[model samples]
Target: MQRYELAAVTGLDSLTRVERDVPRPGPGQVLIRTTAWSLNYRDLLVAGGRYGPPRAGCVPLSDGVGVIEEVGAGVTRVAVGDRVAGIFMQGWIAGDIPGDAGNTALGGAIDGMLSEYVVLSAEGVVKVPAHLTDAEAASLPCAAVTAWNALVRESGIRAGDTVVLLGTGGVSLIALQFAKLHGATTIVTSSSDAKLDIARRLGADHTVNYRAQPDWDRAVLDITNGRGADIVVEVGGPGTFDKSLAALRPGGHLPLIGVLTGVNGAVSTAAILRKHIRVHGIYVGSREMFDEMNRAIAASGLRPPVDRNFGFDDARAAYEHLERAAHAGKVTLTR
Candidate 1:
């Protein structure tokens, strides 16, 4: 087998390909032949050591679409030739997140999907939506599932809700899709008017050019006729969280999912107390959530927005493109 290895914590430069022995599935595990992998901002953080360092030479990708090449003893959920995708949080199978679950995140603490083949516990894999291809299915488990958990499971964003999403990144795009599927009105903000146009075409009810108006949250509030949005996919970190919170209606939901606007250190306790609000810190999702999300996606016939596709060998370039924020949707790499 061949795998990308982190020779050192040298930013994305550390990831390089090398030959390796084909890994055998241990008991309760299955070996997947990776066909497509997707890049996220988290992958950039992990590669640069900001998130954390992986074991040396570890394969580094969280979300993937692959075919089951073999199933080990005790595995019953999947078998050889099954089209599947790995759940990034391998151990978050059901219920609440356990202390042990955080330690098993793919592409970081453990080996990831940037390989020709990988052995993963059968419990961490889910059957891909039948309507999707390898590249499309590869985009789901991380960003799509996280967004679904935020809207459907945590935030309770439903039909007739006015929801706000920050930026045109993967999570926000997926959340936008789900929000529409649930009949919610969606708003998006983007640095580029061009990207905002694309987002509008994808069912966004309105768009704010954040570059022209740094205070995009106000636009969201104004667009909602002062009632504010029912939910905000708060991905902009500290810089935008307070404003995103302000842009929400009293008792609305705020699911903080990213740090693109930088970390928030202090906040107004009084404001939170005065206005009833619910905020959740989303970290992808569990295997069960992925399964539920797949059902919704399949039934709705929703496809993740693909910004661009990179050759599997040019994984580093994919990360670079994402870092530059040059794409309108999910960046993918195909084997």
Candidate 2:
């Protein structure tokens, strides 16, 4: 088997490719031949030593789709030849997140999917949607699931309600699709007018250039006729959290999902108390959530956009591209 390992917490150069013997699946485990993988902003943080120090010699990527090559004893959930993707947290099957969930997270806590072959617990893998390509399915485990958990599972967004998305990253774009699928009006914010135009074509009811309008939250209030958005996908942590609170209607929902900005910042408990807002901290969800999301994706025929595809040998380049933050959607690597 061939794999890329993080030799050190340095930069893209830390990801080194090497060969090793493929390991067989244990009881209740499944071995898969990885076909495609996707990069996330978290991957960049891990590689750059910003997300926390990863284990030495860890395979670095959480999202991938592949074909099952073999199944171990007691594995009945899937069979050989089934196409599947591993859940972000192997231990989190349903309901509340368990205490050991962090230990089971791919890329950071354990060896991930950036390899020619990988073994995962059968319970931790979900069948990919039939209509999506391998690259598209590979994009789902982290980014798409976070978006689904925020809008569908946590917020319970409904028709005619307004939803605000913070940026044109993978999670935000997928949130736009999910919001529109549920009949909610979508408002997307981006620094580039070109990206805002693209968001409009993708069903965004309103677009705001945060660079042009520094107080973009005011724009959100105006668009919603002073009532404010019913739901806000708050991906920008401290830098934009206050504005996100101001842009939400009283008793609205704000699912805090990302820390693209710095981790620590001023938070207004007064506004939260005064407005009677509900703010939920979102992590990538469980396998059951992944299954439900796949069903909705299949029904809606929603294909996640792949901003660029790179060959397996160009893995380092792919990381650099994601670091540049120039992509409009998910970036993928194919074997």
Candidate 3:
């Protein structure tokens, strides 16, 4: 099987095309014929040594959707030809996240799906929602699931509540849909007006062009009639961290999902004290949460926003384009 690997810690420049024999599945495992994969900043970090090195020549991508070509003994949840996505955290199958969850995430500490074939435990592979195309389903494991878990699992967001999304990235966009699906009013911020318009079309009740108004958290306050939003999916790290608190209502939940901005910034303690906000850091969620979120997405006919697709062989180009493309959604690679 042909695959792409970050051969060394030399960054994307070191991504090399190679041929290797595809392995067969042992008992309780399944073999998936990879159809499509999506790239994320985590893949980039592992390649550039920002997230540390992997176990040699690692195939670097966690978000993929594939067809189950073969299943080993004892497999029951899915059968041959079932469309599935691999779990990023192989061992942490379900339940509330344990202290050491995600210790072996695909594309990082272990081999990943940026290849023609891969094998995973039967329980580690889950059926993709019936409605999604391979490209759209490929974006779920990393970005969308994280957003879903932050809102649904951790924050306990409810109908009639107001949710604030920090940016127009993949996670934020997906979270907006889930929030609206649960009957919560959503307010989204983006540096682009054009993208904000798109977000509005996607059911966002309030759109703040962050570029036009850098202090957009204040806009969240104004939009919620000065009560502030009940929750803020704060993706921006230091730059928006303090403002995320400001955007929240008293006793609001701020699920810190990611720091797309460079890490390092200070918090205003007075504001934290005054707002009585609860700040929580969120990683991509468990397989259980993934399944629950998929049910909601499927039932509601939620369409994942996919900005573009690149052919498998042009993997390097895919990474480069994602690095530069201010996509309103995800970029996918068809393998």
Candidate 4:
């Protein structure tokens, strides 16, 4: 088998491909043959030592889909030949995140799916929606699940509510789709007009080019006639946190999902208190959330946008594409 491991806590240069023997599953585990993988901004952060110091030889990807090639003793949740994707936190099955969930995160705390085959707990994987291609299913384990958690789980997003998406990245684009599915008015912001156009085609009710309109919060207010959005998918971290607060109506929801901008800065808390804004820090989601999200995708026939695809051997190029932020949606690798 072939796998890419982070040889040291350096940058992309540390991503080393090496040969390894395919390991077998243990009791209550399953062996998976990977069919597809997707790159998230977190992957770049992990690879570049921005997320944290990862374990040496950590396989660096949290999102991937594969088929069950074999099951260990007492396994029954999934069977051989079933297509499945590993959940982000293998320990988090349902309810609130466990304290030790971080230790179970793939690619960061443990070996991930950037290999020809992987062994995971049978309970840690969920069967993907059958309508999706392997690459599309691969995209769900991180970005899509996070979007679902923010909108469908955390925020009780209702019809006629307004949602402001920070960018056209994987999470934002998938959130846009989910927001539309729930009949909410969607406003998407992006630096690129081409990407904004893509968001529009994906059911965004309005678009803001942050590059053109730097004060986009006021634009959101203007779009809503001085009323503000009901939810702001806050992916920009401290760089855009204040503006996200400004764009939200009183008692609105803010799901803080990413730190695409710098992680730390002075953020005014007065607005949050004054406006009664509900803020939730989302860390991907649980396997139960994955199952619920898959049901929604299957029901609505939702197809997540794939910005680009690379051959499995071209993993470096895929990472470079994500690092450049050139994609408007998920960037994937397929066997």
Question: Could you tell me every candidate's TM-score relative to the true structure?
Answer: 0.98, 0.99, 0.96, 0.99
List model 4 lDDT by residue over 145-251, tens digit each: 99999998999889999999999999999999999999999999999999999999999999999999999999999999998999999999999999999999999
lDDT of 2 at 2: 90
For 6-28, candidate 2 gives per-residue lDDT tens digits of 99978787899999999899999
Colliding residue pairs in candidate 2:
none
Ten-residue region with minimum lDDT total, candidate 2: 47-56
RMSD of each: 1.1, 0.8, 1.5, 0.7
lDDT: worst 10-residue window of model 1? 261-270
Per candidate, the number of residue pairs that clash is 0, 0, 0, 0
lDDT of 2: 0.93
After superposing candidate 4 on the true structure, give the runs of residues whose Cα lies further than 4 Å from its correct spot.
none
User: How do the residues 194-223 of candidate 3 rate in per-residue lDDT, one tens digit apiece?
Assistant: 889889989999898888899897888899
lDDT of 3 at 54: 50
Worst 10 residues of 4 by lDDT: 48-57
List ranges where model 3 is wrong by over 4 Å: 52-55
Model 3 error, position 237 (Å) = 1.0
RMSD of 4: 0.7
- Candidate 1 vs 4: which has more TM-score: 4
